[model samples]
Target chain A: MVPLLEFRNVAVDAAGSEPIEGVSFAIAAGENAVFFGVEGSGLKTVAPLVLGLEEPSGGDVLHRGGTIRGLDYLERLRYKNAIGYLHGDYGLISSLTVEQNISLRLEYYSEYLPEEITAITERLMAELRIIDKRTARPVQLTRSEIFRTAYARAVVHDPELLIIEFAFVDQSPLNIRSFMDVLKARGADPAKSVIFMTYEPQKFVDFADTFIMLYNGRIVFSGSRQDFFDSDNPYLVQYRSTSLRGPMAIS
Target chain B: MMDDERKTTPSGGSVAAYVGAPLLRVWRGTVDFAAYVVSIVLSFRSLRFIRLRSISATILTQTRFTGIDALPFVIVIAVLVGGVVIIQGMTNLPRFGIEGYFSNLMVIIIARELGPLVTALIVITRSGTAIATEIATQKWSREILALEIAGIDPRLYIVIPRIVAFSLSIFSLIIFFDTAAFLGGYLISLATLYMPVGAFFGNLSQAFSMKDLLATIVKSMMFGVLIPLISYYYGMMPRSKSEIPIYVSRAVSRTLFTIIVLNVLVSALLYFSWLE
Candidate 1:
């Protein structure tokens, strides 16, 4: 079967001097892949480029085997209608309430009125298990709560591919595991094409069907979780031990 | 995929190499201003109701963003200016025993030129900066794209209300400022020089024609559009994040300078054309 997504020698110059170079990868439908990289390694840039928010200085982002430009705005919207992208910072609308934010995608895509929105809101609230905090805004929520709400909004339309930037705050191993289980139960398939980006591998190594390590803007390693773990590679060891304090922590 | 496609920036694209950028920016700014005018003009048709959204946004922006918030400052400036001008005229004119000329100077120059000019400058500093900064932040945050992705146009949702709001607000403030200035002149004339209230009003009414009032309103309205348009134009003009604040400052400064220069030019033209 054809891969759901593919990247070929995707070099990009987001800033003139810093070029993200020589990257090629692919993920089949229902295959979960994670990019292990430090900050400024170009992993974060990939999703924005794929989402068509940024233009690549070189290389095309192909969706369903066609270059992104092949589809017009409305057409692209239709394609993205079923794709969920959870940006690293949880890109929540601060002005909107939790329920309103969750239903924002529905309202934007479907133009659902009050009653229809309420119906979707109820279903999504129940699915995400955050029905009690539906009235809270993004600023009012804890990091974990924000994650759940962002995840719920991302999947509200039942997207085929869920692109999540794996984020963990000051949570214990148990809380992290519980949240992972909740995410898995809510429909994130580890074997599917759910391109996840993270700095910490121990928290997400089990979830990756394939691990692609990006270092200094290049894909340095691509292998199974066991191969990545068992290898005594110095780079992998260094990457595995690093912690992600989250986007806001970055200067 | 996007990867195999080679790309290169055009050669000699340095800031200095792009000498025509300023000209291009001016042309683009003019085109933008004209487009707004055309849209406003064509808004009479049923197909143009969408334009009304922009109009409504501009009106609302001018009201909330420009007018009501600016009242205190405008009043203080106008009053002080009026008192100063009257005091200067009263003191100096008495030397020639032509103290009556104070009313004439107060009525014509204050009502016609100083009133609108000062008010516009105040707005360009306050509301104008606010609008530019807000738009600049929106551009930086990718919230602009968020609006576009959500199928909402940023110009209508963000810009139009401000244009409308500043226009009405500026005009309203100009009128208020001129009225306050007149009151200030009267108080100075009454308490110090013992000029009667009726005499001051009579001289003001005689010197200030319906044409003067109409022309003043027109000039203030023009200024309302000019300042916001310049601010919006320059603020939205830059593509790079680093250049946005620079452009906003340039827009505000240029707008204030234009208000002063245009005030002089229009006043001179009006004076020569009418008083001749």
Candidate 2:
């Protein structure tokens, strides 16, 4: 089957001196992938491109095997409706409470009645163990509650491809696996998958079925899970075995 | 190296640089403000069910925050000002033995100028700065981007409601200030002197004409328009937390400058129209 999302040699001149240049990768259907690198890796800019929030300077994106560019209003709306984006900070609205944040997506997008939206939102929140925090705003919640709220909001929308942008970079492997487990239980069949971006890949090493590494404005490596760990590519070795994981002078 | 760089500028070049930099910044800022106004206008569309509800809800929410919650402050200020005006009018004009002209001066000063200017100043210091700080906070937290990604239009949800609320709030607060001050002045006259309430109100009515009303309303409305627009513009302009205070200070200065200029224009127009 064709990949769920694909970027063909994409180039984006968004950030500082080094632009993402001629990078290519594809996420096959029902496969969880991680775009990993150390600090300032340009991976953050890469995720927004998939959501069609930013257009690449060169090359193209094929979403569900069709061109993402030049779609009409309704088509673009439909395309966006199919995605569930979880921002790095959870991206929950500060003014809206947790329940309001989750139900907002449902009521706004779908024609669910107020009662039904409330019921659905409550159910999802309860499932995520965030029902007690439903009335809390983003500012009032703890770090863990914020993550659970974001997860509830995204999953409640029931999107085809869930895009997580670096929310779990510092999470323990056990914590990361638990989130993966929740995702798996949400859709047991291989149809549900994730595209997570992070600087810390060791936490996701066991959970990620594939690795796509960005470095120096290029996709230095993109291959199978074992292919990445097994490869002796100097960049992979640097990433995998670096004691400079904390911080270092970049010149 | 720093000393060498400082020495590179000649006296004339330094002067030119000083003048040119501020002028260039002002020009760029004017252009940016114009673009922001156009963006706000373009954001408006024929209302659909959801957007209409959202906009309505936001406007009401903001109206409560800006107008109703502002009641106590506006009243307190108005009362204190009312007492001060009466005391000054009663005592200060006696050197000319023109105590009868006190009511006329009070009417002109309070009704035509002080009412709206004081109200605008209050809003600028309070809500205007608050709007700028809140926008900066939102931008810092990336909540604006979050709204965009969620398919919500920030202009309609965030900017328009604020504009509407500030406009209505300023209008209502001006009316509140004028009424409370006038009544407060009238009450002081009742207690301190033997003048009848009717005579005191009659003097006030004679001095406070339709032109004064028109001028005050026009100035208040113009102030309302400037406060939110300038606040939103400056609030969204900051690149970092360090720049937040700079942007907010600039916004406050711009708001005051705009309100003063608008007050002069409206007064001139009202006077010219009366002459015509």
Candidate 3:
């Protein structure tokens, strides 16, 4: 299968220093991949490459075999419309209400019919349990509610690939779990792909069909969840341990 | 991925290089800012515009703040300015017993100068702060990047509506201010002195040239664009919350300075070419 997104030996100079060195990874269609690492491990830095917002210093970022960096203006717009990205802080537009914020993607791209827009709004609000808070602005929402709002906005278009960052940190675990479950279910459809990134992965580990672990700018593991859990790799072992003092955490 | 892309900065030990570094930085910044403003202007070339529905929604929302909410302040200032001009005229012109000339003098001062200048300042104080703070907050929050990722150009959704709204609002306010000031001055005259309203009207009618009206409007519209664009430029500069307030302060001061400089320059040109 052609992967939905692939990074080929990508070396990125993050903040004037090369923190992502020769990292290679591929996420095929329908695979919900989780990437986690300690600070400076470069997991959070991967989204910009896939989003075509950044170009790799050394290697290519490809979307279904075509170079992401090569796509022109209109093409890039279309490509981005088909993919959804959720930042660590739930990148909601402050000026827009919760519903306007969610519908913004559809309305901005000029893609939805009035009724289709109404239907999608209803469905996402119901699913995300934000029906009551639809008119409330981003500032009015609680932390958990904002998570739901961000989730609704990201998936409002049924995007082909969704890149989510900090999916579980500071979130109510139940809410994160439910959101992850929905994403996992969506990922079972052959047309969709998910790349989830986080600093703390243990709480949301159950959502990963495939797991990729980064250690000091290099991918130490990229494979099935079963394989990752079974491995006795020092880094994996340290990461899996729940103890306060572990090599997985920054010293 | 972007981090890999490199930028070369100029640095050297030679005497010329030592003197030129700051100058070089300023030159580069000027070019970059010109390019940014031009790019924003170019985005309006209809062929490149985003959905009209999006633009329409944005324009309406922007007008609410720049026009509707600004009406009260515009009115108060207009009335006060008009009264001040008449008060000055009433006290001074009666020595020559040419108090009838108050209408003509008020027309010149209020329409040709004060109308556009005051309107621009009010907008800079009100809409300019809001726009600068809004964009700066958005930039600080990474919401602009979020918009880009969502397939919306921030210029399309953010900047263009403001430019159009400010221009339209200032033009309207200039007309409104002129009307209010005239009526305000006339009311003051009626209360203070037994002047004939018809004669007052006749004097103003005689003095009201299309050139002065045109100059007032052109300045207001130009100022409308300048104020918002300056605010946006400064507002979009900072990446962190700590830097946003500083940018907001800088946006207001720089916007005021630019408006004053441009107002004088344009007025001088108009004086030479038309108003003289």
Superposed by TM-score, candidate 3 places the C-alpha of residue A166 at a distance from the truth, in angstroms, of 0.5
DockQ, every prediction: 0.07, 0.30, 0.51
| Cand 2, B chain, TM | 0.87
TM-score of each: 0.67, 0.86, 0.90
- Clashes in model 2: which pairs? none
Candidate 3 per-residue lDDT, tens place, B1-276, comes to 244442343335555787888899879977987998888867665335355665677898888889888998899889888877877787789899987677777876888888888989899999899998999888877888888788787876787788888889988988899888887877875666666778777888898888887787778778877887888888899867889889999889988988888888877887775546
Tens-digit lDDT track of model 3 for A29-104:
8778888877778876788778877778888888888888777678787788779888777879887888888887
Residue B226 of model 3, lDDT score: 84
Badly placed stretches (over 4 Å) of model 1 are A1-4, A13-31, A38-41, A70-84, A89-110, A114-162, A166-186, A189-193, A205-210, A215-251, B1-62, B86-107, B132-157, B184-188, B193-251, B262-276
CAPRI-wise, candidate 1 is incorrect
For candidate 2, lDDT tens digit of each residue in A88-136? 6777778789998787656554667768788888888777677888889
Displacement of residue B86 (Cα, Å) in model 3 is: 1.2
lDDT of 1 by residue, A105-177 (tens): 5654465565877887787777656788888987898776777777777777767777776555454555345
True contacts kept of each: 0.02, 0.17, 0.69
Query: Model 3, residue A43: displacement in angstroms?
Result: 1.2
Q: Docking quality tier of candidate 3?
A: medium
- Candidate 3 lDDT at A10 equals 93
The prediction achieving the highest DockQ against the true structure is: 3
* CAPRI accuracy category, model 2: acceptable
